[model samples]
Target: MTSTLTAPVQPETVHAIEVGVMQDRIIPEPVGPPSYRASYVTRDTAPGKARRGVVLALKTWGLEQLADTAELLVSELVTNTFVHTDSRTVGVVVTRTAETTVRIMVLDTDRAEMSVPTCPSGDEESGRGLFLVAALADRWDIERVSTGKRIWCELDTKKVQP
Candidate 1:
């Protein structure tokens, strides 16, 4: 009698683990300027904590003018993660993609719960998070992964013209 041998199981590798809106898209190192990134574990106070970190990073990158809007956007994303997902942790990343643009991404671990952003009626108190994100952000998109999804938005950091 003869027996067949089985191969060992290999752990899954996260090929593209950085923050961005594109699934499976590898983020190369910033070629022109330095970028800012931070990750935080999910908690009751995660939104505030993430906001503070983002504010600091934006200031450090000399994008202070975008602080208020960015802070609000980041807070909304973080809140969505904790309020909607069963994720244990969340990743926050802020990157200056161009002289006048900055990208922010929030990653969480709840693949099955992902949904497109929706707008709530004016009288409604909730469901307006993503609506605000789309309004304020120059562009926004979502990316799904093996573990979960990432919601990302890009802002034009340049001063607006009247």
Candidate 2:
């Protein structure tokens, strides 16, 4: 009898494949109140897709007035992940923490060893993403994780006028 052997898969390779698989799957709508989540590949259009998803979810939850600001914040966060890191994909989650509060989180496979967020000068062409997030979000924070880092921002949706 003869046997054949297969090559061993490296952990990094497995992780990369898993991320790729995740990018192709559709993000399911939140089952209960207060949350929506999605994943996207790192591409020029990823931010737009993410923004649309968040806006749609907000609308479904009767938060139409908050769509503009929420979309903008989501775009900024998603764009930053695509532009600043070598990560091939990113994940976005929107959560309603309270009747008036909504939180947006973007996850990327980049480590926290990178530079922190900073405000750019007038002459700069870039580096203003986080500054915009700070201005628009009621509160924001970044946390490092085993796989990557998550940047989150909160908005008071109740303040939005119809």
- Best model per TM-score: 2
Candidate 2 per-residue lDDT, tens place, 39-102, comes to 7888887898888889987898899888998999999999988888889889888888888998
Which segments of model 1 are wrong by more than 4 Å?
1-33, 160-162
TM-scores for all predictions: 0.75, 0.81
Q: How high a TM-score does candidate 2 get? A: 0.81
Candidate 2 local accuracy as lDDT? 0.81
- What is the clash count for each candidate, in the order shown? 0, 0
True-structure lDDT of candidate 1: 0.77
The weakest ten consecutive residues by lDDT in model 2 span 11-20
Across residues 33-124, which tens digit of lDDT does each residue of candidate 1 receive?
Answer: 55555556676677887787778777877778888999999999999889888887787878888878899999998877566666677898
